[model samples]
Target: MARPIWSGILSFGLVSVPVSLYAATEDHTVHFRQIQRGTSDRVRNLRVNERTGKEVAFGDIVKGFETAEGEYVVVEPEELDQISPGRSKTIEISGFVDLDQVEPIFFDKTYYLGPKGKEYAKVYTLLQKALEQSNRAGIALFSMRGKEYLTAVRADRGILTAHTMHFADEVRDPHREIGNLPESGTTVSDRELTMAEQLIDMLAVDWNPDDYKDTFEEKVHELIAAKQAGQEFEAPSAAPRPSNVIDLMDVLSRSLESAGRPAGADADAGGGSEAGAEDEGAGKPRKRASAGRKKAPAEDLSELTKAELYRRASELDIPHRSTMTRDELQAALEQAAVPARHLRAAS
Candidate 1:
């Protein structure tokens, strides 16, 4: 069992509930120790003085700030402690805001907050339910391990989850970093959009995290098993290199076809079915749907008709449908011209 990282009282307005904070997750990735290459001997990292070329004791080590070139001002640990906020043992909530307004980028690490004792359990649960009903998250600040952290606390199921947040200044402006961006003046035809909508419908499915797996980790375990069994195992096949999509319309149309949707189904929707074409080769981009033209009328592809698909595609601004089979139509819809937006990439 994991240990509680923090013991404190959760101050919700006038209510004070004793609670403990525990890490909500763990990463099981493998790590390697540095060693001598040929001898396979372990290597130890040692602190040394640059000018004297002598090993430094832990007691002699002090934190320093470099104010100028080749110069550093050393500060004692006690001096740092004097400046740091002392332990007060209370997570003070300042205000509550609509949870939707909290940007995902600002979230850092999540922790489980549980009542410290039975006396406080009722109030703890009450706070969680209240937050859920209000659709709001509590903004709070707490000092932990001598450092101050801004946190967001929200109700998840029957439990309260607190997530550390990044300061406003830490987030970078994407527009400044990405440089020049394209305008939305590019035109797309109705027919091409229709095919794309149909393709999306065919690929649509409910989002269930259980369906995904870390293939790389699985492969590593399989290789280890084979080696332990004294059996020879071939290396996994390399994935195909990404092919540059030259024609957006053709790509969207082909993508629709690949999704197993009828090429011309609901042309208005864009090109494919409800579940848009998700090519593992072509990364899943949030812009392809949310920031694109618009969603097809049907929430699910199973509910959509061929005519509706075509209409949705037109709304979505995907193009290039004439003189193409169902397969070609799907591909073309996937390649439709669209603006770039920030999205997470699964490795």
Candidate 2:
């Protein structure tokens, strides 16, 4: 169990629930230490006086506010503490609003709010259930660690969660920073729009967070393991950047073709046995007009490269195709082709 970062009473109207705030997430990114080249010594950072070139003691450090005249007003930590939010023990809920009403950009860090003691559990659970049923979040002011934050408290699963938010002034206008955005009056033809929608529908799948992996982190760990074993690490080749799309209709049409068969059909319509035998024979690869199971009607699978096979598998919505070997992809594609061909026949 982790220690709570904050403990306070969550108050709304006449109700008050004693709660403890625990960090809802953690950073798992790999970190590296700065070291001198050709030496094992770690680099050190020191706070020093610019004029005297002498390292300053930690006790000498003080908060300084620079004036317009280039003079700093030295302030003691105790003096700053006096003006701090004063660690208010209450998170006062101002009001409740629909969760969707809050823009995603305003949200910052999240913290889980648990009942501080068993005596408070019933009230805590009641608040959580109310928020969940209402599909709304409570907007509140929370003072912690010398600062006050505008926060949103909502029910996540069976518990209450709080997310710190940025004030309106902190968010900038996107138009000022971004250029070359599509014109407001720009429009697409109905046919093109329909085709794009079809492509999206064909490629759609259920959301599963577990399906995603941190490939960069995995590679970093692999590199570290190789270095520890006294082996040289060769970087993987970078993928080619896609060329800009000049023809919207062409792109949409190709995308639809690549999206293979629709869900739910016979999985053995195509000549599966023949495809497997041909794959075993290891014949010369061929390039198809479009990288999809059913799109390239006259294309031969035995002639396609591993990259082409993977692309076809992707269009067919094969799970975990990214980590599959060339042989594995080919086999998967063969199995996928059955339903794809069946759908084509029905169509």
Candidate 3:
């Protein structure tokens, strides 16, 4: 079971429920330690003073704020508390709003909120059901780890799920970056749009998180097991894509036909399929090939040329391509190909 990180009362109006919070998500991406290339020595970060160019002892460090030219106000722990004595005990709900009205962009970290004891279960269930019936989320403020956070509490499967939120200023305006681009209207035709919609309909399904799996992680573990068993490594090949996608509409039409869905029906109308359910949360966006390998114009691998293979590999940003032999290149290319193959196959 996941451990609760904090325990406190969720207070609002005249009601208070003792509750505990546990992290709702975790990072699964592979991580590696920094090391020196030649000696493979693990790198260690050091604390050094910028002004004196000398290493500083943690005990000697003091927090300070610069207030004027060449001047700083050193602050002690007790003194710092006098400046801003933020509330650390309460998760105080101030208001409620429709859950849909809160955009996904505002969501930050998520936490699972559970009743601290049987005594609090009644109120917890009451709050959860109330929020569910109203289809609303509670806006609350809480302090943790010395920082204050605004959070939303909503009913999910009979429990109150709390999500920390980003301030309006934190979400960057997508328009600012894409503002100068030419209008997409000129590039998209009505036929292409219709086909695209059809393709989307073909792939549509209700959100069922249980279906997702981390195939890449699974493949990595499998490869590790094979390596441990001293199995011979087979050279990897790039899956071929059609060199010329005659027309985007054609592919969309084929995809829709393959899915057995009519173009006009709602994308998610069909009941449900369990085939790809395991891949729900673990699936990520598509990736490009390495810089050294040639890219296939289409997503399939058979349509690639030797030159395109080089380009695709390069686009994927694979390393050590310049001096690598064909066999080595193929092995490197496999790393990029496997995840994509799994996504397409699983989907």
Candidate 4:
């Protein structure tokens, strides 16, 4: 079991439930130490006074707030603690509101909030059930680490969970902050809109976190292993380019066809297939396009991005496609195209 990061009382309307908070996530990203270039010597950062050029001890440092008049007010950590809203112990729930009413942008870090002891289990379960049935979250204010946080507590998988929230002022207005946002009057043809929607429908997938991994993290591990063995690693493929505005419809049509839907499907008929559903039955290879149909020219394969090449390989049902590099995928796709080309020439 993990140690609780916080232990506090959760109070609402004279009822108090003691709870322990645990971190809900972990950082698996690769981290590195600072080292001097071309040497094994370590590089380190030290806190020093700019005026005296002397290293400062940790205990001697104090927080400073710069004022508009060019003076700084030095404060101690104990003073900040004394002025905290809840004094780092109590979380007072003000009220409950519909969970969906809170925008996603307002949510921040999450914590697994569990009852402190078996004695408090009944009250904790009661609140969890109430929040679960009502589909609402309890809004609360709490102090921790010398700072006050607005948080939302709710039922998650039969237990209590809490998410620290951003205050309204902290969230910026995108309309004011951003410059390149599309105009409200930007328009596309009805046919293009329908085809785009159709393409989206064909590629829609179920939300399963287990189905994906951090590929870049895996690549980093691979890189470390290669460097340790003094071996060369292949460079990453170039990113796919943006589609041409003039060929938007054509791009949509091609995307749908690549995902196993026919290009000529009726636009008004909500044209899509259960292709995405087929992918969920994992480990089995995808069904290929009709073999009798002539394929695109082989030389054109070089122009396509790795993603496009991978899609072509999937359509051809090439073996070991997942493990293939970008160049290997293109080669597999070109090899698959040869039989179709031969049939056309033999005829």
Q: How many residue pairs clash per model?
A: 78, 3, 40, 0
Error of 2 at 169 (Å): 0.8
Per-residue lDDT of 172-280 in model 1, one digit per residue for the tens? 9987778676555875576566555545545455577898977877777778889989998789889865645467666776676554434443344333333454332
Which order, best to worst by lDDT?
Answer: 4, 2, 1, 3
Rank candidates, TM-score, best first: 4, 2, 1, 3
- Please give the distance, in angstroms, between residue 331's alpha carbon in candidate 1 and its true position after superposition: 29
Q: In model 2, which regions exceed 4 Å deviation?
A: 75-87, 232-234, 237-243, 261-347
Whole-model lDDT values for every prediction: 0.69, 0.73, 0.67, 0.79
Q: Against the true structure, what is each candidate's TM-score?
A: 0.68, 0.71, 0.63, 0.76
User: Tens digits of per-residue lDDT for model 2 on 1-347?
Assistant: 99999988898999998889999999879999999999999998999998799999999888888886668988886665466353367788989999988899999999999998899889999999999999999998867765778999999989999999999999999888789778899986665665565455445545778979888888999999999999998898999667456776555555544544222211222312212222212342222224453432334588766556656765455655544666776777776666667777899
lDDT of 4 by residue, 1-347 (tens): 99999989998898889999999999999999899999999898999998899999999999999996658999988788778646488888999999988999999999999999999999999999999999999999888887889999999999999899999999999999999999999988776776776556445545779989999999999999999999998779999999999888778778867755543443542432323213321433235445543354657777876566656665555655545666787787787778877877899
Name the 10 consecutive residues with the lowest summed lDDT in model 2: 265-274
Between prediction 2 and prediction 4, the one with superior TM-score is 4
Better of 2 and 3 by TM-score: 2
lDDT of 1 at 104: 98
* Candidate 3 lDDT (Cα, 0 to 1): 0.67
Q: Put down candidate 3 lDDT per residue, 28-105, tens digits, no spaces.
A: 976668999999699989899988889999998888889998799987765544444534656889999998888998
